[model samples]
Target chain A: MAELFISISIWPWLAYTLAGLVQVTLIVTLVAVGALVFIWLERKVSGRIQDRLGPTRVGGRFGWLQTLADGLKLLTKEDLMPEGADEFLFRIAPYVSFCASLTAFLAIPFAGGSYPFVALHMNTAVFFVLAVLGLEVFGVILAGYSSASKWSLFGAMREAAQVVSYEVPLGMCAVVPVLLAGSMDLVVIGDRQTGTFWNWYLFHDPFTFITFWVYFTCATASVNRAPFDLAEAESELVAGFHTEYSGLRWSFFFMAEYGSMLAVSLLASILFLGGWNGPIPVASLLGLTFENGFWLGFAGNVLGTANLIGKGVAGVTVMMWVRWTLPRLRIDQVITTCLKYCVPIAASMFVGATLWQYAFPNGAIFPQSAAAYQVREPWNAKAEAKSAEAARVEKTASREPVATEFTSGRTAEAAPLSARTPDPAG
Target chain B: MEAPIYWPTFFFLLFSAIACAFAVAVVVTPNIVRMAFYLVLSLAATAGLFFLAGADFVGAMQLMIYVGGTLVLLVFGVMLTSQDRFISMKTSGFELGVAVTLGVCLFVVLAYCARSIPEWHGMKAKQVSAVPLEPTAAPLGMGLLGARVDGPDRSGYLLVFEIISVHLLVVLVGAAYLARARGKKNLLVE
Candidate 1:
């Protein structure tokens, strides 16, 4: 998009600014719309689970516009601040949370390949996303501290402990895919499993299969979702961190929650599931690739985007299902789940996966040597090969002239390291 | 026609301004919690500066380890230590003078080192843009694993990496031991 603006050659800085605005608008819209849809979906899902109807009168029989109606009400509602609350921190807390949650979407690619649909194409996208996502806790902490309520302080403390603990296992679980793909770039990881369903890292080995579940558990806990949402346990903490918040400000926290839920779900899909690649390579089968034509590539990317979003939504739905079905764990239980179960399980899986990779370097078993089962080399293969060539050229260029007999003898094989050093006379 | 605005310089100035302003705020603020918040913003702006300087990995690490992790822990510690409202710690004039002297000396040394490098002097826009975006992750990984991919003539930092990691592990173990409950004294003796 920036390239398009630059090509026009009209106020280049303005073009860059406009391009940035467009990207920000797109990501913010996605987060807002996602929050709306997910809130409605959550209510509906919970209603079904509890054997009741939710928001039947808001928009229609199905109440499709329930979230929108709720949003409107929130906007019109009074914005109140506690007399003891720190005015500045209290006012900015929700925006901080929302911004951190939204910024994570920048590095996440919605599609893969030569033309990936990412706002910011980062080499270390997985790490960047996780890092930014962790910043969301600041908002909660600030909100809690500034609110001057004991309950809010307790909630913030619980959150600080929980998030800090969960990050350990969460990072370990995330690294398994990075190890398998030999790259931290999400596009590279996604491109590796381009062929079929079995190519998904979740099914690559028994360890990773177990790791996926562990990752999900840690991810769930890290995002503060039930059955691990001790930070905002309503029955005990009375709305927890955001107790003093109301109106649009309170809604920002909710949006941040759903935004992070969607972000982690998307990351999980890209890491463990086939990412933009479908169970069956529908785009490939239909010959819709960049190699064919521009339109074909566009179609392929569109399809890939749908595939990724579908997988992410599926993950979110599963989270919702779990949230509705299971009861929230106590604070101690939540910590134990992270440290005792998730951490140990993730660590062992890391070791097992490393060993599995060594034993079966091809990333397949039972049907080894089959051309179809071979993992595709990452997109950086060409660059690496070029670098290797450059290294070889450098080595040859630096070689010193030796005695005639020695040179003749060593011509068949590569010269020793010492002899390769450049002489004063070339 | 000349471009109206240079984007990189604009962003660099913006980030540096924010970092400097927030850092001042951190020192000036009387409220401890508000001071912590200012420190967070300052550190975050410094991370932005890192990103602008083409150190993406370092920027992300700064955000993760310093701004996100360490500062959160700092806030948690502050909260635990002082639960009173509007708590502030006042420093003596001697302490402030000492700190200012040390900071100035350190700044002078850093400025001298930066000035010693010929390449650090005025660079043209063309020179800046001529350098293509290089992926630092692969070479960084190789360097850590005792292989110098950037320049094969140089030795890798694998030993240093291992030593630092082990040092960190020892520190973590020591911290855990110190923080552990005293009720398990009998078990420890056993």
Candidate 2:
């Protein structure tokens, strides 16, 4: 019954559209709700971090609904347009940024196997995410350029420059994880590290451990977060490219930022840490397989999803900590960090990992036996078929007593095998 | 003996339509920044087209290297070089006429050649369906690592992949060298 419910209709494309719409809705809602919750959390966290009580008057004892109230205020505020601003581009920029942020999730696999909770289950999902993430810069660029304000233009230009430069090291860092996994499918990569915590890419090797840090630096820079957020430098550009924005539109920019923050954090989680796999294999040991009863399987998946979200949240929390703690890097310094430091480190790590993989086909640091705890029969039909063929061939070649080769033709092989048997033996 | 119009042919048609449309838009648009923006959309669509054409590796390449890296750089150039003069290039009437004449002629010849192919015209629409646009990453990877033994039963892209990688490295270094501010900044690491 559940399989029938999950199955698509005959015309595949109708199913495609339905699935795409559902995934988009899911990601959008989650991101929107997440943004609301995160905004409040950030305020609360910063408040505690800076030794003050943040927003204690909106909804409850802790002002838990402050973000909601703030959102309402933003929605009610008047929309303004500065003189000389390119009207079309200005209006479109935020949506473009917001859309780019949302679209990356279309390719990201949340849970399940090959056909996962991903919107578009493209083989090049990892590539698609990086491409879409890079596109977020365009909206910033458009917002800055079309604003007709010098500060806005400056901010946009800085963002454009920073993001483009940062993508190099980011790509290099990303390749390390892909390299280790031996496949670009995020579902495959995530599933490979299934059994335990140590199976994560961060612990794949010493080089990967270093690569994770490099990846984080690039991610921070790419997202225009603190220490690399010269584009929105408060002192210089007067809130940078988004200076012209207000109310809901301004909130849209923040939503995009937070959305992207969650995304990159998730990327780090999947690439470095074992995605949907906890520190302990309690679920595994408890006999919770996908083949288990529906309720049991669902409970297992829910636990895994919670685990993935927790890892992602931890990554976001780390980003917030870094934001509050470290001072923003200068534009030159940020570029230097990427081009000189991150790039070289990522490149060397890539090379080191390559050599390591060759020298030790099996992972040296951790046990491969643990990696194999979750048995992944990689959907390799061809390999299985070939093996089956070889087995059949061996059976045919040998002096087999009763070789009923039923790999393909059961009737033909069975009839002949029975006929070949002597009457006495029968 | 008759040759068949394979899946790649249909993909070529679809991709060419999109790539040509967006490329023409880039050429037609006068505003430099708008031109850059249009170019981004075009290149991305082209990347999609590449994926459709069973060049999954190239499609990812188109996205990662082209749209993400090159086009972003192009947009930055648009932002930077977009200071005063030449914000929009208004071509002269004569130049426009000449350009249009050549473009039409080239397109006509190409279209004529495409139509002239009997083998290409022979296949049914269903027979010419592309190598499913969904989940092309694995075959592409196999092609790259030189082990396309199964799925597509096609040859790997090792030699070209290697060359493209090397080419990308060169392009990176060259672009950096060219774009880097002279003397005022830290140009050399060593």
Candidate 3:
């Protein structure tokens, strides 16, 4: 979109800014709409599980407008601040949490092809997502502390310990897929798992299969869902860190929670499940790959996006099911489960997967050939081409003598870096 | 007409300003919790600077380990040590004056050193803007695993990586020991 404006003689800065705004608007809409849908889905799923009709009256039989109604109610409610609360911290905590949750989405690719759809493309996207996700705990802790309530404090403390502990194993679990794919880029990881379900990292090896479960457990715990939701144990800590929050401010925390839940689920789907790739290569079979024209490539991407979202939503549904069905673990149990079970299992699986990869370099089940396993250099190729073009332009611009020779020298230096650093697999 | 705004430079200025402002806020905030919060904002903005400098991996690590992990530990410590009584500890005027003078001196020295670097200055705006956003993850991973993939002459970080891993293990053990709850018998033993 920015390129379009730039091509049409608009100022580069304005075009870029407008493009960025559009991108942010799209992402915010995705989160907000996803949250609304997930809330409604959760109620419906929970109701069905308990053999009850959830919200039948709101938006016809399914009550699709329930979340909308809830949002309106929340907006109208008095935004209450605790008497002894730190006003600034209390006001900003939810935004911090929401922003952290939202930032993780910037690195997440919804689809993969010649031009994958992502807000920002980071090479270390998995790590970036995990890191941003971890920042959400700060907001929780601040909310707990600033609320000046004992229950809130307890909830925050529990969250602090739980999230910090869970991250260790969660990280370890995530690395197993990175190990399998041999790249930290989530798009690359997702692309490597293309073709079929068997190609998914979860089914790649026995160790990875086990690692996926461990990843899910730690992911669930990391997101503070039951049975690991000791941070918000309603029976004991009222509403946990959010005990003092009311109305829209309270809803923001939930939005952050649901957003992170969806993000983690998406990450899980991308890492363990086939991501945008389904059980079968429907798009490829339909000749909708990038080799086709632009429209067909877009169609493929759309299909892929749908597939990825379906997997993510499925993961979220499972989480909702677990939340409804299982009993919340005690704080001690949560800690023990992470330390004793998840961490050890993840570590052992990591070791096992490493050894497994060493034994069968291609794969055990599918046994893809070396040629088939060749890492794609498309991103590098495009980057190199762009840098070369940029260097040529810089050279021409430098001939005018207004621009310094240092600029040309720097461009020349950058050209080699971009061109030569193709594949670091060796 | 005015010169076109360089977006990257504009963003760099924005991030740096936020980072510097929040760093000062961290020092100025009286409440310990508020100080920690400010420190987080400062560190996060610094991470943004790292990202702007095209060190995405380093930026993420800064966010994860420093802002996310270490600061959480600091906040936990603050919460455990003094919930209400020491929430806002007032520093002595003399100490504050000394700290300010020291900080000013350090900043001046750092700024002088930063400005002294020749390669850091006079880069072509076109060149800076044209640098491709390449994924540094692979080269970083390879370097960690004892392969100098980024450059032919450069050395790998294998030994340093191993040492860091060991150091992390030691730190973990130390933390576990320090945090271990004492029984009646252990108290007597102590």
Best by lDDT: 3
Question: Largest DockQ belongs to which candidate?
Answer: 1
Docking class of 2: acceptable
Off by over 4 Å in 1: A366-426, B1-4, B92-119, B183-190
Q: What is the C-alpha RMSD of each candidate to the true structure, in Å?
A: 6.9, 10.0, 8.1
lDDT of 1 at B32: 89
**Tens digits of per-residue lDDT for model 1, A351-407:** 999888767666565332132211212213333344565334333432211122122
lDDT of 3 by residue, A186-217 (tens): 88888878887888888999999999999999
Q: List residue ranges in candidate 3 displaced over 4 A.
A: A369-373, A376-426, B83-86, B116-119, B129-133, B185-190
Candidate 2 lDDT (Cα, 0 to 1): 0.75
| Per-candidate local distance difference test | 0.83, 0.75, 0.85
Q: Which stretches of candidate 2 lie over 4 Å from their true place?
A: A1-14, A370-426, B1-21, B121-190
* Candidates 1 and 3, the one with greater TM-score: 3
User: Which should have the higher DockQ, number 1 or number 3?
Assistant: 1
lDDT of 2 by residue, A142-201 (tens): 899888888998898889888988888888888887876766777767776777777888
Give TM per candidate.
Answer: 0.88, 0.83, 0.89
Which residue window of length 10 is worst by lDDT in model 3 chain A?
A: A398-407
For candidate 3, give the DockQ: 0.35
